[model samples]
Target: MSDTISLVVAGGGTAGHISPMLAIADAVKDEIPGAEITAIGSPGGLETKLVPEAGYRLELIPKAPMPRSINLDLFKFPLRFIKAVNGAKRVLKESNAQALLGVGGYVCTPAYIAAKKLGVPIFVHEANSKAGMANKVGAKTAVAVGTTFANTGLPGEEQVGMPMRSNVAQMDRAALREEARAFFGVSDQNPLLLVTGGSSGAQSINTAVAQSLGLLADAGVNVVHITGRGKQIMDASGQLLAHERYHQVEYVDRMEYAYAAADLMICRSGAGTVCELEVAGTPSVLVPLPIGNGEQKLNARELVAAGGAVLVDDKAFTKDYIAGHVAPLLADQHKLEEMSRAAAALGRRDAAQNMARKIIAEISSRSTSGQEG
Candidate 1:
């Protein structure tokens, strides 16, 4: 076993999961110059690209998603589960990882199960107000459970908040806005509306925004829409606007800039986006994703209660309704300022640092107890 302080962050299905893993890796490296992080994810998940792109080595692991239906694939679950655990064991042994950290997903099963078998410490970070199935199962064995929600159902879980990127923690509104506007080539006079539905994009949100493009332009709101690649929305209406005023992209590499360019945001209430909005101090109109046992709704609830955002039900997200709700917010400077303040107050910018400190302490304690790897 190597004495190097190494971590294996395992799990991924969305940017929400992958991004936090990267944030923690960054935090660990910042605190411990010699720390190393390796991510293990399935072949085709977003982590395949995001993990490596974020400057960390990625180990591809074969893990099958749990099928919802009673199909022949169910028979493979037992074999695949065993194979995944074996694969995780190989990674832990090869990388000399001192601890296994599960970030919450189906891909988490192997590392979590392997850690328990090898008598290695397990740490988990759940990024939702409610527990996901993977987190729920992994919680029983976690040495420490970190979470974004204060009321995480798992016993002994600490509310460590959601880990965020370095840029999010360091954002200064005055400086960021000027830089972001210039980066996007947006004019200062126009009300900038940044719209996104996470990395894969929000289809309903995009369609509604597309339908309301004319109304939005007429209201003097310049729009930057990050429409995901598959959900195409290019048309004559969005194209007719001056190219300088409107920006559409399938994905945004520098989200800090996007957050900076906007006067107000209209987007899905994923944990990452909501956390970033709070760090950036930008007001938002939240359209929670109607999936995953109402996780997004729960995330939005805290912000709405804090006066940080306005929550719109997915069913009520029509073109006219969105235009009606967004029009006045764009028109009113005073209300926007209040929302911005509330958003800033609601953010937990130190989450990544806090998680890193605790993990380091735990690993150090274990090493002192003669469990060093």
Candidate 2:
């Protein structure tokens, strides 16, 4: 039997899911040398753009949300799911995939079902402390489940931690800090505050940060804010004055630089974001997303429990609180340095390669059985 392994990665709606999926795919390729990976995503979601941009083949599927509770839109779910599963089946067959890794979203369901129907080995990666609906359903049949958090429910789950991008994972912090400061046009004399509201920016964060721009600037904090594209409150405080102190961006193309450049980060607590911060050893004030069932908060709790981060409630995320929480940390260089060490120590830098190696082994075993029969 040939040694090449083929696998499909299904699930992606947000940067939280898509970034880790891409990282895993990259890891598989790196470890196996000739492994083939295809990602399945919704046509209009972030994955449609990001997966292709990351140089992986994306198989678009038709999918719609399954409302957790009773909703008017729930009626259309059956029809949408049928179409999506059909799309997933087609992609799996065309790609000759031996396994499917579900990353936990509505779009992941169809692919998981398709793999089950075809007798393909299914693995799942649950990035949250709480298992999403999709992963919960797939759990019964999943051969193995990997998690970023320790207690994400699955029968035979392994803690693989979260996989960061090769670029971010392999970065040299000392050198990166120098280059990142240069990228933002900030010198070592001035401390930098890097703020982001996730990939698409959170309005509450954007508004608070924007409104507190003068306070930030006045405190000698050169701001590198990722305000997200087309967000209404992006520039609410004032226009960015380049070469002075403030650097405002719609999106951050270079995350390594962002981590290296910042003295402290004020941001939302998505699993991937938290992983990146820890991996880069950047201290942050994490404001969990005030939506959903508080999964983001749970993620932050893990970091906080480890003494790696400070958690600020979303309700308490006003300018005064922002200044009170962040300013003090930035002002005390000793605290910043200690937190940085803790954050870095909490990071599992080898997680990407570990996960990639495991998935490739599973695929190889499945392929061997298929060839033998």
Candidate 3:
């Protein structure tokens, strides 16, 4: 009601963070049609390219990666952090941001402090089951804390699910099944497996798949493999591998097609992927990243618990595991369909719109109170 809603979306270094941030932007824009959204990201982070590509203005701040151990970088941390906060403050003032929506990351810490300094309402969404350090700090005084998982233990936690792309969230795989399969050159009678290692690709996963290609093909499973950029599986001759049943691409621009066409998936279990699988109702074999704070493992917990996915450690996901576990699962059409139903039940298709309504409601409440006062 007070002109147009202005928001600062903070967080992005990877697709995990940027995707949900964009989802929030898309939902808010859908509601207000002319809402102003400015994204704050670190200069070298993936957001530099993605935010601008999505038609949102990108504001870069100095990277403020937290040092785990005392090192030369630790000495430089404080000064860099202060500068990042000051830069965030400048963006907030310039945009006159009424509310700041942050999906947790290194970038959000400064943005959170900056938004609080200016008395702008701060809303945070934590996508992992284990909250990141940045989000824990912001949630201390956030207007509200929305979470994709129930047990993050953050203050004021609300299980609002993930803010996912509308195409994924609203996908009716059953309706699109025929078209999607045809688009991927997969037949309805044959099992289809979608394999990906995310944007940068996971070497471990790629190697495992490289070894399992012959086995998968023998089982009559068609594969659409996304090898990340420059991670394509190649033959002994240094050319891309050739297989009649295998289609390999560096990346997928429209993932909805991949999701709809795939009966099962083998991929990393980042929070974003877990949620998308749930939305698509595609059962998967999830290999949680071997690093970080074990958040990836935690992110896949509920889905695994619900029988939607099978969890394997990065090291244990070898060619033997693929032959003994994955190939058999793909052959079991009944079990795959059952897992798909369980996964679908866990997806909250309205997360973006739900979070959107909360942010807009917060803005309206402030305006109403100001007028009444």
Candidate 4:
């Protein structure tokens, strides 16, 4: 065996999957500086750019979404999966991969199959409260499984929390408040509100925030609205709305700034967002996406139960709800402070290091045992 062990990380299709994948990859690199790391993702996903930009070589496989119903696509599913598995096998075999790490996505199923066939040790991280189709299958045969939430329904999962960006995991909101506020061009005196809907933006969230802007302004709250790409809020004349306290950006490269700056957030409660909110200890009024097997609601359940956050129905999250709900929350400093503290209590600041160390220990043990044999 070579001195360096080769590893492959598999996940993609969306930022939710890609972000944690990269974080885990970074952690793995830290844990084993001599380890050779490669990544596997679908061709069209965000990983195409993000993976390479992070300085790791990437291998592309075709996406193989599990078909839900009887359709022509269902007929095509088997062929697609086989091709993806073949693609994954080529990457792993050529790299002589010793282990495989996967966060759930369309690409994971094939990677899992390829790794199993090659006798590579498999580790899986499931970031949602409920396992997706890929993870539900991957976890059954994986050597070790990790989860962001308890009772994720994946077999033999250990709650190592979500592997998140170091900036988020180590964010000191109180200390970074002033700098974060300045970065968003907001006043530290006023409570800040952040509204986001991920990379593609949420139409309903954008509308509600736009309609409630005046009410929020009256309550002396400043706003930072991330309107997704090509989704900026515009006036009747189709010009981007401009207000002294209302800052609009289609995307933010440095979301830690926004998270640190805001007193509250109104956004979907994806696993990544929920984990980030806890890590940042930022109070949020969660608006779970009204689709996708109700996983978002499950994602928010623990935080809401802990009094760190609140949830609103997708349809009910309108201007009126903003006035009756959000405005009052922003006004009460004591309440906000309490919620912030509650959120902070649930944060796992060392999750990346924890998961990384586990990977290294497990892989190292395998190598040692093999050499002795």
Instruction: Summarize candidate 2's per-residue lDDT along 158-260 as a digit string, tens digits.
Output: 8888877878888777778877888876776678899998668888887787777787778788888787787634233564433346777778788988888
Q: lDDT-based ranking, best first?
A: 3, 4, 1, 2
lDDT for each candidate structure: 0.83, 0.82, 0.91, 0.88
Clashes per model (N, Cα, C within 3 A): 1, 0, 0, 0
User: TM-scores, in order shown?
Assistant: 0.93, 0.92, 0.97, 0.97
**Error of model 4, residue 108, in angstroms:** 0.6
Q: lDDT winner between 2 and 4, please give it.
A: 4
lDDT of 1: 0.83
Ranking 1 against 3 by TM-score, winner: 3
Residue 99 CA displacement from its true place in model 2, Å = 0.9
Segments of candidate 3 deviating more than 4 angstroms: none
lDDT of each residue in 38-147, candidate 1, tens digit only: 88888888888888888988887787677788889998888888888888888888988888788888789777888888877888898988888788878898888889
Per-residue lDDT, model 2, residue 156, is 81
Q: Report the Cα lDDT for residue 98, model 3.
A: 89
Clashing pairs in 2: none
- 2 or 3, greater by lDDT: 3
Question: lDDT at 362 for candidate 1?
Answer: 83
Q: Which stretches of model 1 miss by more than 4 angstroms?
A: 1-3, 236-244, 371-373
Q: Which residue pairs collide, candidate 1? A: 2-373
| Cα lDDT for residue 196, candidate 1 | 88
